[model samples]
Target: MVVTTELVGLIHMTTRPFHNLLLPRIAVLLVLGALPSCAEPAAPVHGGAGTSPTQKSRPPEKRPDSSYRPPRGFTELQSVAGRVARASGHKIVWRLQPGANPGPLVRIRGTVNDCTIFVHPLAARKVPPNTWAFLFGHEFAHLTENLGTHSATSPENELQADITGARYAMAAGYRIEAFLGWVLTEPDQKSDSHGSLHQRVRAIARKFGVPWRTIERESKRAASYRAGR
Candidate 1:
């Protein structure tokens, strides 16, 4: 009987009640640890151990104005038009015909359907014969590419035309860079989606490294021809 009673007493001790107050302390020990000798967390092995790649390194932002634009010329732009027109593959035909208003001060760069390239003169002094030729070639390329239809808003295409302008002038044996310096201009409000003036100017200038003095000397070709020179 004594052995049986002792067994019961041990069972009672093993089944003793757990107080609510003891749980918090146990939880704290499990979380924080009771031992004061716990080592400090080891320093990170590498500086970028846990960061996302994007968070670790940011990409560069683009500036809207980071484009090219050449300076404005003093003389009327029509002068360059004459020279450009004279140099184009297809002869650029010009005539003083007043018509229904199409758009603002924008030039009609190429012939729409007609085989012979033509640009409507804004005024008699509009784009002189020479300047219009190169512009005509540019427009002709555009017409060929169907730019007026498919990629009208694309900035890159217009830039290609700018390059074409300088190229045509060079092919005509004129000083390409000087004419480009004058010809590289803005599209006014109509050209919002186009690249800025500086970028266009630079693209042309980079292509035609023709000397500056050549441009100045040939400046008079605005109203006159220099052997398509």
Candidate 2:
């Protein structure tokens, strides 16, 4: 007969003359065991490829003042965003959020919140007309895909957005290839949020029917120019 320690303990406890006295205490302990421990925070819920922690962490650090205004070319970007939304068949609503303004007419990237596309002031001010159009096209494509706040790290979703954006840009007479070349050459910064540059460039090229060799050549040239080599 196998007498496991647990069974032995149970037998011993049951045979004890004091077992009735321990019953109330044992019941209390059992009830207490059912309660959850408060030592740690509950895990955050995620839906599909939602925004990463790194991307979410940026907002508080980069938050602008209440009175902060969007940079120049706001009107132009708004117009382009509207056009791209219509072209992409999403018709997403647009809103400009506060943030530091830097780079050309485009610098920061826009994000989707619900059915609305939120553009940062820096993004609005830095990019050229074509880049601006392409960016909005990409964001609006997210809406068309019904991907709400999906993580940019999702390669499939990101590529889909890029393909849709590229088509919209080309239709609107924007130089999407040039924008893609610039993107491909830029140093890797947001890998957790957007995945690898090579993957992105390849996906965009494949989807848009652009020759990968041309994009690769252009990216290398752009990189060399930036490096002053």
Candidate 3:
């Protein structure tokens, strides 16, 4: 994916320290297969670790800003996000933006204490709930594992997130196969930060103790079926 000037500017802004406060790591989910380094500022919120419980307690949902009208499928996105958050035991604030730019499908802001996930309206309408679970799971893994502040390489951070995120998705009862299927449709190219599609798929499969070849076969079939339709 081509990084626009606006995104570059935003990235620069996020990296700068503001008021001597610790900046939250901004994890961007690139739909077209690029990844950016994390650097952003936001307040704090408490989060938990480990897999989600079989039965989860519903947390109080935060209402969106009244000034902006929600896009189509926003409600469904909220529902799915809530489930993922509960499964991860994290309190997240969700926002929907009107821009349909081909930059990031989701932008995570804020530290562990005050985290907000910004989703583009286009992603809300177009991506499936199960896929969103994996995306959310990946970001939450970053937050929970403190991958942003660690000295690990970018690819290492991303691979770790993929493994932990798959666990979170499973705990939330979302189908892992759905996420694998979606990955099949994404560009297989690698970036300076994110791994190639194959690497991510293998990491996630290992998390579930699934054979790489099995997932590869199944995912291709699923992708083919969707394409044929």
Candidate 4:
């Protein structure tokens, strides 16, 4: 009888805590259910290490500007353009257009279409020697991928050409300053056919190891000039 009573007592002791826990839970559920129907729903809990569920994440920052500098060897214009073209495994036929209207004058310096390159002699004579060479290099770069004018207006293609052309110009021994004079003096806005002067200048500056400050200085100078005029 004592053993039976002891076993019964142990069973009661073991179930006491379980019964206590269940009663509170049931009471809580009943209290929640009895609350006013108009009560606001509980806020949802999120499970992340950092950042709130309602907050939007910020976009990534743009890449920092970089600089490059090339060694000297800049000489003949055709030779440099040839080197750039050859580097891309292409051979070009150079053509000189007669009049300004049908030449580079009508279309801003030079162009490479298919296997041929066209430039106006009159237009060539107007810019600094290094810039002239750079122009040739730029056009040659367009022909490098054998894409020609088909990708002319594409920003990606145009940027690639500018970067490649700048490198070619550097290889040909032209300093970044050579093109900066013309670039700063005549900043072209973004167009359907080309990038903004800002984009071009930044690309050239990045490729040739020129400082962004130089462009800033030139822009300020140009702005001042315009203001003065």
Candidate 5:
């Protein structure tokens, strides 16, 4: 069939085998059909949302990190990201890559040539799909900001991304305290990378107004900020 040859050729472009690529045209069409066409989907909250939610109403609660598995409802994450990208007048590509951060904080690492917003396929698939979406947004913030810069030397750029990501995550109904609990606990750094954990968490906390107590506790500066308050 005319369609068959074209489909086969396209499949051949994949690293998979010929037999693997040889699927019924209907099956291929169905698979492609299900995916949303988001050519230039709307940008997400590029310029910040209207107002911040007060953390005063809630008790001092500790939210455990969300499951880090392959995403079950990842499409929603993509749609949300698309909106942010559109709003920001930017774009992002989500992919499952090797060497995802083995820790809780959603990792966002990329370079100039072949950048991708990584989503732990297995982690994203588990419960608390919102966690994965938050990570996706976090990475996008990095990508979009980095797009405006030439090198990755700016720690402010990264912190800005963290703030951007936190805003989206908070707006998306993810517990900022919970998310930051996992993030601030992280105790490693690339020598060439940004500042200490205290700096990063504070940067994100300020953006979402996640409460001064929360940051103080995470940074182990609780007594310091608390005494002043």
Candidate 6:
């Protein structure tokens, strides 16, 4: 998912400053429109022809932010982002925000050369490492491919991200099934900008050559594991 600083206006219009109280100064551009909620996955598109090839390049050095103290387990998340970024041949600046209900994993493009991803603390703690690869991989696709910049709607943008992200994560050595399982957990709602969960599942399944039954099995296993925990 992607968002821009215009969210400030949205906050004011809704009189709901609490939702984005800690939003950074960075200006984020969302080609896929405003996301409904953190749990909601971004939109979709068909075909794999437009996917960008991964170029070999050095990962960008971390920019120092004295006010930013790395949260516990942040290093691990950074590692996941690094793996995805390397596989996509894009430099990403990863950041964690302090909040119980912060936004989804979103990519912020301050400029053509600057791309950053921000996630909630809860997401970092609750989502497993393999799933993180999928999440970051999704945002990495948006950043590298410059998706939604043209006439694509939210569903088109999100579907494209799903396909590209799965490829990048797979290239980075993460299981594609993990992403399908994660998608199964999302609410199956079809919105103006995003597709229903089932639609996304089918799209991703077709793209990765994975069976829908396999994804369903993984989802059940994940649920059982969580229940046991």
- The candidate scoring highest on lDDT is 6
Computed on alpha carbons, the lDDT of every model, listed in order, comes to 0.38, 0.48, 0.52, 0.44, 0.42, 0.53
What shift in Å separates residue 138 of candidate 2 from its native position after superposition? 1.7
If both were scored by TM-score, which would come out higher, candidate 1 or candidate 3?
3
Writing each residue's lDDT as its tens digit, candidate 4 over 1-229 gives 1110000100111123323433454456557774222134422322335656343343322211111111112223345456555544455554423333222321222333333343333233222345545655656665554334532346666667667766676775565554654456553456555546556667667767778777666455434432332
| Candidate 6 residue-wise lDDT, 30-71, digit = tens | 234442233443222112355333312322223211111122
C-alpha displacement of 5 in model 4, angstroms? 99
- Angstrom error at residue 2, model 1: 99
Give the per-residue Cα lDDT of candidate 6 at 150: 17
Q: All candidates' TM-scores?
A: 0.41, 0.52, 0.60, 0.49, 0.45, 0.62
User: Between 2 and 4, whose lDDT is larger?
Assistant: 2
Tens digits of per-residue lDDT for model 1, 77-151: 334445555655645454212322221222343243333322222222222333433454555455444444222
Native-to-model Cα distance after best TM-score fit, residue 226 in candidate 6, in Å? 2.9
Per-residue lDDT of 1-229 in model 5, one digit per residue for the tens?
1110100000011212212222233245457774323243532322145422443342424322232222325565556445444444444444434324332223444432235444433233322443444455556666555422323345665566656765655565556665554344344333334555455666666766789676446434322221221
Q: How many clashing pairs per prediction, in order?
A: 23, 7, 5, 5, 22, 7
Which ten-residue region of model 4 has the weakest summed lDDT? 2-11
Winner of 4 and 5 under lDDT? 4
Model 2's number of clashes is 7
Q: Which residue pairs in candidate 4 collide?
A: 67-209, 68-208, 68-209, 74-172, 74-173
RMSD in Å for all candidates: 37.5, 24.6, 14.6, 34.9, 15.6, 14.9
Q: In what order do the candidates fall by TM-score, top score first?
A: 6, 3, 2, 4, 5, 1
